[model samples]
Target chain A: MLILNVILVIFLIICAVAVERTKDLLGAVIIFAAYSLIMAVLWLMLQAPDIALTEAAIGAGVTTILFIGVISRTRRMEK
Target chain B: MDDIIVKTITRLIVPFIQVYGIFVILHGHISPGGGFSGGAVLGSSMILFTLSFGLPMASRKIPHKVTSILETSGILWYIIIGLAGIYLGGKFLVNKEAGFFMGQAGELISAGIIPLLTLGIGIKVASTMITLFHTIIEED
Candidate 1:
């Protein structure tokens, strides 16, 4: 389990880099949402349900909503 | 550097990452992972999405004020819970004496209001992360 966890962490780290490399801001947001979801799962596996739920709702849900709103405001500004 | 590898890698690893994040959050009471760690993961995930999809795409689904509210509300929830514990005739965050939980270390109800506190913390951290992501992604 420890080894698996390590591998997962490494994977997350790499994905994080992917988020930085992507040019499409929307794609980046999706990846970031994925990142938050994964983190929530990790938290659950680690035994923090409260945290996990918060991550899912606030991190993945509410925050995402906010990002989308901002995106709509500035869609024309993108290259 | 390439889209294919990055996309494939994201597709493969993202699930595991999210699962692990939940694991950590749940295991916080039993181990090192907790609300803070889980929240950080959420923030980073959104950040990644922003980087790959562009800030507009990510922001299109949500707005900055919502995140700000989440952050502040989470904090208020935490303080309210703690104060509730105090109002109930125990010290701030008083667990065993407060009668909010069973008082057993491993028991779900044992931590009294700690879990609630953690929930608030997780929200706060995650929302804050989103706020930061908005700032970075919006920048030209």
Candidate 2:
């Protein structure tokens, strides 16, 4: 359990940095979605199922769609 | 976007997502999930549909006007229910003192006004998500 938590946290840090470092807006959004998924799973492990559910639905689901829509309206590659 | 396989899979899966969302909303009082989470789940299903089919078809199914009405009515319903407590000579949003029926613990029909409030919140949140997504997507 501790090892799993450590691995998730490490992945989360990597995703956070990669989202910022990525030059492509769409790739950043996708990475952010991955970050959210990992955070949701961590929330579940922490016994806050409600937060986990919200994180998955809003973070992984709707936010990704919204971000993609914005990217379509503007540009996919960051300046 | 125009793939037959994507459309077929979306059609097959959306119903289950919606059912699970409703289940989460309805069982909120006795379970881990509540209005916001369930409503997000419900709204995401519609979003998935929009992604699979085009925006035109999705908008036809859940029009902007319908979502607007739903958003307004959800809050209106919540306010009406809350005011019922005052009408019954108690504090605003009071449950037991408001004469609401509280059933057994962990039952579906228990929790008095909480379930009703959750329903209102669920409706509001779901409509809000749909409206926001539609507006963002449709902007020129």
Candidate 3:
């Protein structure tokens, strides 16, 4: 259990850093969605299933689409 | 957006997503998910449809006027429910004292006024999400 938690946390950090570093806005949004999914799992492990559900829906699902829409309207690459 | 694979998959999956969202909203009082989360899920399904099939079709499925009406009605329903409590000689948003039916614990219909409140919130949230997404996408 501890090992799994550590792995997830590590992935979370990597995803966060990657999202910031990526020049492609689309890639960043996808990475952020991944981060949201990981956070949702962590929330579930921490016994906050309600928050997990909300995070998964709003973070991974709706936020990703909204970001994609914004990226479509604006520039795909950050520059 | 014109990919046949994506369209086929979306068509196959959207109904299930909507059903799951409704399940979450209806079981909210007894489950971990509530109105807001479930509504997001529901709204996202519509978004998925919009992504796969053009926005025009999606807008036809749920027009702006319809969303406006739904948004207004959702809040109105919540207010009406709250007023019922006051009419019953109880404080605002009162539950059991407001004469609401509280079935057995763990049952679907239990939790006086909570499920109704969740329904109202679910409708409001889902419509709001759709409206926001449509506005942003249609802006330019």
Instruction: Give interface RMSD for all predictions.
Output: 5.3, 0.6, 0.8
Rank candidates, lDDT, best first.
2, 3, 1
Alpha-carbon TM-score of each model against the true structure: 0.58, 0.96, 0.94
Model 1 stretches astray by more than 4 angstroms:
A1-79, B1-4, B107-109
Q: Model 3, B40-67: lDDT tens per residue?
A: 9898889889888988999999999999
Look at candidate 2 and tell me the lDDT of residue B119. 93
lDDT of 1 by residue, B71-100 (tens): 999999988988887988568866666667
TM-score of 3: 0.94
Report lDDT per candidate.
Answer: 0.73, 0.93, 0.92
Runs in model 3 deviating more than 4 A are none
In candidate 2 chain A, what residue range of length 10 has the lowest lDDT sum?
A: A70-79
Task: Give candidate 2 misplaced runs (Cα > 4 Å).
Answer: none
Model 3 lDDT vs. the true structure?
0.92
Query: What tens digits encode model 3's per-residue C-alpha lDDT throughout A1-79?
Result: 9999999999999999999899999999999999999999999999999899999999998889888988898889899
Best by TM-score: 2
lDDT of 2 by residue, B8-33 (tens): 99999999999999999999999999
Q: DockQ scores for all the models shown?
A: 0.06, 0.91, 0.81
Q: Which ten residues in a row have the lowest lDDT in candidate 2 chain B?
A: B89-98
User: How much is the lDDT of residue A18 in candidate 2?
Assistant: 99
Descending-TM-score candidate ranking: 2, 3, 1
